[model samples]
Target: MEEQAKQKLKNYVLWLLSRQEYSRRDLTFKLQKKEASPEYIESLLDWCESLNYIDETRYCEGFIRRHLAKNHGYARIKSEAGAKGIDKTLLAFQIEEMEIDWFQLARTAYIKKFSNITDTPDYKQKAKIVRYLMYRGFNYEQIEFAYTHNQS
Candidate 1:
Protein backbone atom coordinates (compact mmCIF):
# COMPACT_ATOMS: atom_id res chain seq x y z
CA MET A 1 0.00 0.00 0.00
CA GLU A 2 1.06 3.56 -0.65
CA GLU A 3 2.06 5.87 2.16
CA GLN A 4 -1.13 7.89 1.79
CA ALA A 5 -3.32 4.77 1.89
CA LYS A 6 -1.65 3.50 5.05
CA GLN A 7 -1.98 6.91 6.61
CA LYS A 8 -5.63 7.01 5.62
CA LEU A 9 -6.22 3.68 7.31
CA LYS A 10 -4.36 4.84 10.38
CA ASN A 11 -6.33 8.04 10.50
CA TYR A 12 -9.57 6.14 10.13
CA VAL A 13 -8.67 3.85 12.99
CA LEU A 14 -7.78 6.80 15.21
CA TRP A 15 -11.01 8.50 14.22
CA LEU A 16 -13.05 5.47 15.16
CA LEU A 17 -11.30 5.13 18.50
CA SER A 18 -11.65 8.80 19.34
CA ARG A 19 -15.41 8.49 19.19
CA GLN A 20 -15.63 5.53 21.58
CA GLU A 21 -13.64 2.70 23.11
CA TYR A 22 -13.83 -0.58 21.19
CA SER A 23 -12.74 -4.10 22.05
CA ARG A 24 -9.66 -5.36 20.22
CA ARG A 25 -11.73 -7.76 18.18
CA ASP A 26 -14.49 -5.23 17.64
CA LEU A 27 -12.07 -2.62 16.34
CA THR A 28 -10.41 -5.20 14.09
CA PHE A 29 -13.71 -6.19 12.56
CA LYS A 30 -14.66 -2.54 12.12
CA LEU A 31 -11.41 -1.73 10.32
CA GLN A 32 -11.83 -4.80 8.15
CA LYS A 33 -15.19 -3.51 7.08
CA LYS A 34 -13.39 -0.48 5.70
CA GLU A 35 -11.33 -2.79 3.40
CA ALA A 36 -8.09 -2.74 5.43
CA SER A 37 -6.12 -5.93 4.69
CA PRO A 38 -5.26 -8.59 7.26
CA GLU A 39 -1.54 -7.81 7.37
CA TYR A 40 -2.08 -4.10 7.71
CA ILE A 41 -4.81 -4.69 10.21
CA GLU A 42 -2.58 -6.77 12.46
CA SER A 43 0.26 -4.32 12.17
CA LEU A 44 -2.01 -1.43 13.02
CA LEU A 45 -3.39 -3.28 16.00
CA ASP A 46 0.09 -3.99 17.23
CA TRP A 47 0.97 -0.36 16.93
CA CYS A 48 -2.16 0.71 18.72
CA GLU A 49 -1.62 -1.73 21.56
CA SER A 50 2.00 -0.83 22.00
CA LEU A 51 1.21 2.87 21.92
CA ASN A 52 -1.54 2.40 24.48
CA TYR A 53 -4.01 3.74 21.99
CA ILE A 54 -6.30 0.76 22.51
CA ASP A 55 -6.18 -1.05 25.81
CA GLU A 56 -8.76 -3.78 26.25
CA THR A 57 -8.45 -3.63 30.03
CA ARG A 58 -9.07 0.08 30.05
CA TYR A 59 -11.91 -0.40 27.61
CA CYS A 60 -13.44 -3.01 29.85
CA GLU A 61 -13.11 -0.74 32.86
CA GLY A 62 -14.68 2.15 31.01
CA PHE A 63 -17.48 -0.04 29.76
CA ILE A 64 -18.10 -1.17 33.29
CA ARG A 65 -18.15 2.37 34.56
CA ARG A 66 -20.66 3.47 32.00
CA HIS A 67 -22.93 0.44 32.27
CA LEU A 68 -22.84 0.37 36.05
CA ALA A 69 -23.64 4.05 36.20
CA LYS A 70 -26.55 3.27 33.93
CA ASN A 71 -27.66 0.67 36.55
CA HIS A 72 -26.70 -2.49 34.64
CA GLY A 73 -25.74 -5.80 36.29
CA TYR A 74 -22.83 -8.22 36.17
CA ALA A 75 -24.54 -10.77 33.96
CA ARG A 76 -25.57 -8.24 31.36
CA ILE A 77 -22.17 -6.55 31.23
CA LYS A 78 -20.37 -9.88 31.08
CA SER A 79 -22.48 -11.14 28.21
CA GLU A 80 -22.07 -7.91 26.31
CA ALA A 81 -18.29 -7.99 26.73
CA GLY A 82 -18.18 -11.64 25.66
CA ALA A 83 -20.14 -10.82 22.54
CA LYS A 84 -17.44 -8.28 21.70
CA GLY A 85 -14.77 -11.01 22.12
CA ILE A 86 -13.41 -9.92 25.49
CA ASP A 87 -11.93 -12.75 27.55
CA LYS A 88 -14.02 -14.23 30.34
CA THR A 89 -11.23 -13.85 32.86
CA LEU A 90 -10.95 -10.15 32.21
CA LEU A 91 -14.69 -9.72 32.35
CA ALA A 92 -14.87 -11.62 35.61
CA PHE A 93 -12.17 -9.50 37.15
CA GLN A 94 -14.02 -6.42 36.09
CA ILE A 95 -17.19 -7.72 37.67
CA GLU A 96 -15.40 -8.65 40.87
CA GLU A 97 -13.85 -5.25 41.20
CA MET A 98 -17.12 -3.53 40.41
CA GLU A 99 -18.78 -1.56 43.25
CA ILE A 100 -22.33 -1.80 42.09
CA ASP A 101 -25.10 -0.73 44.47
CA TRP A 102 -27.61 -3.30 43.38
CA PHE A 103 -30.48 -2.18 45.56
CA GLN A 104 -30.22 1.47 44.66
CA LEU A 105 -29.86 0.58 41.01
CA ALA A 106 -32.79 -1.75 41.13
CA ARG A 107 -34.83 0.82 42.96
CA THR A 108 -33.96 3.41 40.35
CA ALA A 109 -34.95 1.18 37.49
CA TYR A 110 -38.11 0.07 39.26
CA ILE A 111 -39.09 3.62 40.03
CA LYS A 112 -38.29 4.90 36.55
CA LYS A 113 -40.47 2.27 34.97
CA PHE A 114 -43.05 1.77 37.68
CA SER A 115 -43.51 4.42 40.30
CA ASN A 116 -44.78 3.87 43.88
CA ILE A 117 -44.21 0.11 44.00
CA THR A 118 -44.80 -0.05 47.76
CA ASP A 119 -48.23 1.50 47.49
CA THR A 120 -49.54 -1.37 45.40
CA PRO A 121 -50.52 -4.50 47.31
CA ASP A 122 -51.74 -6.50 44.35
CA TYR A 123 -49.64 -9.47 43.30
CA LYS A 124 -49.70 -8.37 39.70
CA GLN A 125 -48.31 -4.94 40.55
CA LYS A 126 -45.48 -6.41 42.58
CA ALA A 127 -44.81 -8.90 39.83
CA LYS A 128 -44.52 -6.07 37.35
CA ILE A 129 -41.82 -4.40 39.43
CA VAL A 130 -39.96 -7.69 39.77
CA ARG A 131 -40.20 -8.35 36.08
CA TYR A 132 -39.08 -4.85 35.24
CA LEU A 133 -35.98 -5.10 37.42
CA MET A 134 -35.19 -8.55 36.06
CA TYR A 135 -35.52 -7.27 32.53
CA ARG A 136 -33.10 -4.47 33.39
CA GLY A 137 -30.51 -7.15 34.30
CA PHE A 138 -30.81 -6.91 38.09
CA ASN A 139 -30.18 -10.04 40.15
CA TYR A 140 -32.44 -11.77 42.68
CA GLU A 141 -30.67 -10.19 45.63
CA GLN A 142 -31.14 -6.70 44.30
CA ILE A 143 -34.70 -7.29 43.21
CA GLU A 144 -35.70 -8.66 46.61
CA PHE A 145 -33.95 -5.83 48.38
CA ALA A 146 -35.67 -3.21 46.26
CA TYR A 147 -39.08 -4.84 46.50
CA THR A 148 -38.91 -5.39 50.25
CA HIS A 149 -37.71 -1.92 51.01
CA ASN A 150 -40.19 -0.36 48.64
CA GLN A 151 -43.00 -2.20 50.42
CA SER A 152 -41.94 -0.62 53.65
Candidate 2:
Protein backbone atom coordinates (compact mmCIF):
# COMPACT_ATOMS: atom_id res chain seq x y z
CA MET A 1 0.00 0.00 0.00
CA GLU A 2 2.79 2.39 0.89
CA GLU A 3 4.55 1.52 -2.33
CA GLN A 4 1.38 2.17 -4.28
CA ALA A 5 0.92 5.55 -2.64
CA LYS A 6 4.51 6.50 -3.35
CA GLN A 7 4.12 5.51 -6.96
CA LYS A 8 0.96 7.54 -7.29
CA LEU A 9 2.71 10.56 -5.81
CA LYS A 10 5.63 10.05 -8.12
CA ASN A 11 3.37 9.99 -11.13
CA TYR A 12 1.70 13.15 -9.95
CA VAL A 13 5.04 14.85 -9.51
CA LEU A 14 6.14 13.83 -12.98
CA TRP A 15 2.97 15.27 -14.39
CA LEU A 16 3.54 18.54 -12.57
CA LEU A 17 7.16 18.66 -13.68
CA SER A 18 6.07 18.18 -17.24
CA ARG A 19 4.12 21.43 -16.98
CA GLN A 20 6.87 23.55 -15.42
CA GLU A 21 9.88 23.51 -13.15
CA TYR A 22 9.14 22.98 -9.49
CA SER A 23 11.39 23.49 -6.52
CA ARG A 24 11.67 20.65 -4.03
CA ARG A 25 9.61 22.57 -1.53
CA ASP A 26 6.98 23.26 -4.13
CA LEU A 27 6.77 19.56 -4.89
CA THR A 28 6.62 18.66 -1.23
CA PHE A 29 3.81 21.10 -0.65
CA LYS A 30 1.88 19.69 -3.55
CA LEU A 31 2.33 16.15 -2.27
CA GLN A 32 1.26 17.17 1.15
CA LYS A 33 -1.84 18.72 -0.32
CA LYS A 34 -2.58 15.39 -1.95
CA GLU A 35 -2.18 13.74 1.49
CA ALA A 36 0.93 11.84 0.52
CA SER A 37 2.83 10.38 3.46
CA PRO A 38 5.51 12.75 4.66
CA GLU A 39 8.10 9.98 4.83
CA TYR A 40 7.33 8.82 1.32
CA ILE A 41 7.38 12.35 0.04
CA GLU A 42 10.86 12.93 1.39
CA SER A 43 12.12 9.65 0.01
CA LEU A 44 10.51 10.32 -3.32
CA LEU A 45 12.04 13.78 -3.41
CA ASP A 46 15.42 12.22 -2.81
CA TRP A 47 14.83 9.73 -5.58
CA CYS A 48 13.81 12.49 -7.95
CA GLU A 49 16.85 14.54 -7.09
CA SER A 50 19.14 11.56 -7.63
CA LEU A 51 17.62 11.05 -11.05
CA ASN A 52 18.35 14.71 -11.95
CA TYR A 53 14.68 15.10 -12.75
CA ILE A 54 14.61 18.06 -10.44
CA ASP A 55 17.68 20.21 -10.74
CA GLU A 56 17.50 23.29 -8.55
CA THR A 57 20.33 24.94 -10.42
CA ARG A 58 18.54 24.53 -13.71
CA TYR A 59 15.33 25.85 -12.19
CA CYS A 60 17.14 28.80 -10.68
CA GLU A 61 18.86 29.71 -13.92
CA GLY A 62 15.67 29.54 -15.91
CA PHE A 63 13.82 31.52 -13.23
CA ILE A 64 16.44 34.25 -13.19
CA ARG A 65 16.56 34.41 -16.94
CA ARG A 66 12.79 34.77 -17.28
CA HIS A 67 12.53 37.37 -14.53
CA LEU A 68 15.51 39.31 -15.82
CA ALA A 69 13.95 39.39 -19.24
CA LYS A 70 10.91 40.89 -17.54
CA ASN A 71 13.30 43.47 -15.97
CA HIS A 72 13.12 42.40 -12.35
CA GLY A 73 16.00 43.54 -10.10
CA TYR A 74 18.32 41.44 -7.95
CA ALA A 75 16.46 41.94 -4.69
CA ARG A 76 13.21 40.72 -6.20
CA ILE A 77 14.97 37.80 -7.80
CA LYS A 78 16.67 36.81 -4.55
CA SER A 79 13.49 37.09 -2.53
CA GLU A 80 11.45 35.07 -5.01
CA ALA A 81 14.11 32.36 -5.25
CA GLY A 82 14.33 32.12 -1.48
CA ALA A 83 10.59 31.88 -1.17
CA LYS A 84 10.57 29.09 -3.75
CA GLY A 85 12.91 27.03 -1.49
CA ILE A 86 16.14 27.39 -3.42
CA ASP A 87 19.25 26.90 -1.30
CA LYS A 88 20.60 30.30 -0.36
CA THR A 89 24.18 29.35 -1.05
CA LEU A 90 23.35 27.99 -4.47
CA LEU A 91 21.21 31.00 -5.28
CA ALA A 92 24.02 33.35 -4.32
CA PHE A 93 26.45 31.47 -6.51
CA GLN A 94 24.01 31.44 -9.40
CA ILE A 95 23.32 35.16 -9.06
CA GLU A 96 27.04 35.87 -9.11
CA GLU A 97 27.52 33.69 -12.16
CA MET A 98 24.67 35.42 -13.97
CA GLU A 99 26.52 38.76 -13.75
CA ILE A 100 23.31 40.76 -13.79
CA ASP A 101 23.39 44.52 -14.23
CA TRP A 102 20.92 45.78 -11.65
CA PHE A 103 21.44 49.41 -12.55
CA GLN A 104 20.85 48.82 -16.21
CA LEU A 105 17.89 46.61 -15.46
CA ALA A 106 16.41 49.29 -13.21
CA ARG A 107 16.84 51.89 -15.89
CA THR A 108 15.21 49.67 -18.46
CA ALA A 109 12.35 48.85 -16.18
CA TYR A 110 11.80 52.50 -15.31
CA ILE A 111 11.92 53.52 -18.93
CA LYS A 112 9.59 50.76 -19.95
CA LYS A 113 7.01 51.76 -17.37
CA PHE A 114 7.27 55.52 -17.64
CA SER A 115 8.45 56.20 -21.15
CA ASN A 116 6.17 59.13 -21.80
CA ILE A 117 8.07 61.53 -19.58
CA THR A 118 10.16 64.04 -21.49
CA ASP A 119 11.47 66.18 -18.61
CA THR A 120 12.58 65.85 -15.02
CA PRO A 121 9.52 65.02 -12.97
CA ASP A 122 8.38 67.11 -10.06
CA TYR A 123 8.91 65.93 -6.46
CA LYS A 124 5.56 64.12 -6.36
CA GLN A 125 6.10 62.44 -9.70
CA LYS A 126 9.66 61.55 -8.75
CA ALA A 127 8.46 60.03 -5.51
CA LYS A 128 5.86 57.96 -7.34
CA ILE A 129 8.42 56.66 -9.77
CA VAL A 130 10.87 55.94 -6.97
CA ARG A 131 8.25 53.97 -5.09
CA TYR A 132 7.40 52.00 -8.20
CA LEU A 133 11.03 51.18 -8.86
CA MET A 134 11.59 50.19 -5.25
CA TYR A 135 8.55 47.95 -5.36
CA ARG A 136 9.99 46.36 -8.47
CA GLY A 137 13.00 45.27 -6.28
CA PHE A 138 15.71 47.79 -7.16
CA ASN A 139 17.90 49.09 -4.36
CA TYR A 140 18.08 52.80 -3.65
CA GLU A 141 21.45 53.20 -5.31
CA GLN A 142 20.33 51.48 -8.48
CA ILE A 143 17.06 53.43 -8.59
CA GLU A 144 18.90 56.71 -8.06
CA PHE A 145 21.40 55.81 -10.70
CA ALA A 146 18.63 55.09 -13.14
CA TYR A 147 16.75 58.26 -12.29
CA THR A 148 19.79 60.49 -12.54
CA HIS A 149 21.31 59.04 -15.65
CA ASN A 150 18.23 58.20 -17.61
CA GLN A 151 16.16 61.28 -17.00
CA SER A 152 16.48 63.74 -19.85
Candidate 3:
Protein backbone atom coordinates (compact mmCIF):
# COMPACT_ATOMS: atom_id res chain seq x y z
CA MET A 1 0.00 0.00 0.00
CA GLU A 2 2.85 2.38 0.74
CA GLU A 3 4.50 1.64 -2.59
CA GLN A 4 1.15 1.98 -4.31
CA ALA A 5 0.60 5.43 -2.76
CA LYS A 6 4.04 6.63 -3.88
CA GLN A 7 3.39 5.37 -7.39
CA LYS A 8 0.10 7.20 -7.45
CA LEU A 9 1.80 10.42 -6.41
CA LYS A 10 4.48 9.95 -9.02
CA ASN A 11 1.94 9.33 -11.74
CA TYR A 12 -0.02 12.38 -10.73
CA VAL A 13 3.10 14.51 -10.81
CA LEU A 14 4.03 13.24 -14.24
CA TRP A 15 0.55 14.01 -15.53
CA LEU A 16 0.75 17.55 -14.17
CA LEU A 17 4.17 18.09 -15.69
CA SER A 18 2.94 16.91 -19.04
CA ARG A 19 0.39 19.72 -19.01
CA GLN A 20 2.73 22.58 -18.01
CA GLU A 21 5.94 23.52 -16.29
CA TYR A 22 5.97 23.90 -12.50
CA SER A 23 8.66 25.23 -10.22
CA ARG A 24 9.83 22.93 -7.44
CA ARG A 25 8.14 25.11 -4.85
CA ASP A 26 4.90 25.17 -6.80
CA LEU A 27 5.01 21.41 -7.16
CA THR A 28 5.61 20.96 -3.45
CA PHE A 29 2.72 23.18 -2.54
CA LYS A 30 0.49 21.37 -4.98
CA LEU A 31 1.38 17.91 -3.72
CA GLN A 32 0.94 19.07 -0.16
CA LYS A 33 -2.53 20.27 -0.98
CA LYS A 34 -3.29 16.76 -2.16
CA GLU A 35 -2.59 15.51 1.39
CA ALA A 36 0.67 13.73 0.61
CA SER A 37 3.22 13.23 3.40
CA PRO A 38 5.91 15.89 3.52
CA GLU A 39 8.74 13.41 3.64
CA TYR A 40 7.33 11.40 0.77
CA ILE A 41 6.75 14.55 -1.26
CA GLU A 42 10.31 15.71 -0.63
CA SER A 43 11.71 12.43 -1.79
CA LEU A 44 9.50 12.50 -4.86
CA LEU A 45 10.62 16.04 -5.60
CA ASP A 46 14.22 14.89 -5.31
CA TRP A 47 13.55 12.15 -7.77
CA CYS A 48 11.93 14.55 -10.15
CA GLU A 49 14.88 16.94 -9.88
CA SER A 50 17.32 14.10 -10.51
CA LEU A 51 15.40 13.19 -13.65
CA ASN A 52 15.32 16.82 -14.83
CA TYR A 53 11.53 16.81 -14.61
CA ILE A 54 11.37 19.87 -12.33
CA ASP A 55 14.15 22.29 -13.14
CA GLU A 56 13.96 25.80 -11.75
CA THR A 57 16.11 27.27 -14.52
CA ARG A 58 14.05 25.72 -17.27
CA TYR A 59 10.82 26.89 -15.67
CA CYS A 60 12.16 30.40 -15.22
CA GLU A 61 13.29 30.60 -18.84
CA GLY A 62 9.91 29.55 -20.18
CA PHE A 63 8.08 31.91 -17.85
CA ILE A 64 10.26 34.82 -18.97
CA ARG A 65 9.73 34.02 -22.63
CA ARG A 66 5.95 33.91 -22.31
CA HIS A 67 5.77 37.18 -20.36
CA LEU A 68 8.15 38.89 -22.80
CA ALA A 69 5.94 37.97 -25.71
CA LYS A 70 3.10 39.75 -23.90
CA ASN A 71 5.21 42.96 -23.79
CA HIS A 72 5.69 42.92 -20.02
CA GLY A 73 8.61 44.86 -18.52
CA TYR A 74 11.28 43.56 -16.19
CA ALA A 75 9.64 44.74 -12.98
CA ARG A 76 6.32 43.07 -13.78
CA ILE A 77 7.91 39.86 -15.02
CA LYS A 78 10.13 39.67 -11.96
CA SER A 79 7.21 40.24 -9.64
CA GLU A 80 4.98 37.67 -11.29
CA ALA A 81 7.76 35.12 -11.59
CA GLY A 82 8.58 35.53 -7.93
CA ALA A 83 4.98 34.86 -7.02
CA LYS A 84 5.18 31.72 -9.11
CA GLY A 85 8.11 30.54 -6.94
CA ILE A 86 11.02 31.45 -9.24
CA ASP A 87 14.25 32.67 -7.67
CA LYS A 88 14.88 36.40 -8.14
CA THR A 89 18.61 36.04 -8.79
CA LEU A 90 18.08 33.37 -11.38
CA LEU A 91 15.41 35.43 -13.07
CA ALA A 92 17.60 38.53 -13.11
CA PHE A 93 20.51 36.56 -14.54
CA GLN A 94 18.34 35.10 -17.27
CA ILE A 95 16.94 38.53 -18.15
CA GLU A 96 20.45 39.93 -18.41
CA GLU A 97 21.60 37.05 -20.58
CA MET A 98 18.61 37.51 -22.88
CA GLU A 99 19.55 41.16 -23.58
CA ILE A 100 15.92 42.22 -23.85
CA ASP A 101 15.04 45.59 -25.40
CA TRP A 102 12.92 47.02 -22.60
CA PHE A 103 12.65 50.44 -24.20
CA GLN A 104 11.36 48.96 -27.43
CA LEU A 105 8.94 46.75 -25.54
CA ALA A 106 7.67 49.70 -23.54
CA ARG A 107 7.18 51.69 -26.72
CA THR A 108 5.34 48.80 -28.28
CA ALA A 109 3.07 48.45 -25.26
CA TYR A 110 2.38 52.19 -25.34
CA ILE A 111 1.49 52.14 -29.01
CA LYS A 112 -0.69 49.09 -28.63
CA LYS A 113 -2.71 50.77 -25.88
CA PHE A 114 -2.86 54.32 -27.21
CA SER A 115 -2.51 53.92 -30.95
CA ASN A 116 -5.50 56.08 -31.79
CA ILE A 117 -4.06 59.24 -30.24
CA THR A 118 -1.68 60.80 -32.74
CA ASP A 119 -1.26 64.27 -31.26
CA THR A 120 0.75 65.07 -28.17
CA PRO A 121 -1.26 64.50 -25.02
CA ASP A 122 -2.13 67.24 -22.53
CA TYR A 123 -0.95 67.11 -18.91
CA LYS A 124 -3.91 65.09 -17.64
CA GLN A 125 -3.72 62.71 -20.60
CA LYS A 126 0.01 62.30 -20.10
CA ALA A 127 -0.59 61.43 -16.47
CA LYS A 128 -3.09 58.79 -17.48
CA ILE A 129 -0.70 57.34 -19.99
CA VAL A 130 2.10 57.25 -17.47
CA ARG A 131 -0.10 55.49 -14.94
CA TYR A 132 -1.18 52.94 -17.50
CA LEU A 133 2.39 52.20 -18.55
CA MET A 134 3.49 51.93 -14.95
CA TYR A 135 0.79 49.40 -14.22
CA ARG A 136 1.99 47.42 -17.22
CA GLY A 137 5.47 47.14 -15.54
CA PHE A 138 7.53 49.83 -17.33
CA ASN A 139 9.89 52.12 -15.47
CA TYR A 140 9.75 55.95 -15.58
CA GLU A 141 12.58 56.20 -18.11
CA GLN A 142 11.00 53.64 -20.37
CA ILE A 143 7.59 55.29 -20.07
CA GLU A 144 9.06 58.68 -20.89
CA PHE A 145 10.80 57.32 -23.94
CA ALA A 146 7.69 55.53 -25.13
CA TYR A 147 5.41 58.56 -24.99
CA THR A 148 7.91 61.14 -26.20
CA HIS A 149 9.18 59.02 -29.06
CA ASN A 150 5.73 57.94 -30.16
CA GLN A 151 4.29 61.48 -30.15
CA SER A 152 6.80 62.77 -32.64
Residue-level lDDT of model 3, residues 1-152, one tens digit each, is: 28888898899999999999998898899899888999999989999999999889889999999998888998899889878878889999999999999999999999999998788888988999899889889999999999889954
Better of 1 and 2 by TM-score: 2
Candidate 1 residue runs with Cα over 4 Å from true position:
118-121
Best by TM-score: 3
The segments of candidate 3 whose C-alpha lies over 4 angstroms from its true place after superposition are: none
Ranking by TM-score: 3, 2, 1
lDDT of 2 at 48: 88
- List TM-score per model, in order: 0.88, 0.90, 0.94
Runs in model 2 deviating more than 4 A are none
TM-score of 2: 0.90
Using alpha carbons, what is the TM-score of model 1?
0.88
Per-residue accuracy of model 2 over 1-152 as CA lDDT, tens digit each: 47787778889999998899888888999999999878888888899899988998998888888889988888888898878778888888988998888999999998898888767777987898899998889999998888777764
Residue 97's lDDT within candidate 3 is: 91
RMSD of each: 1.9, 1.8, 1.5
lDDT-superior candidate, 2 or 3? 3
Error of 1 at 112 (Å): 2.8
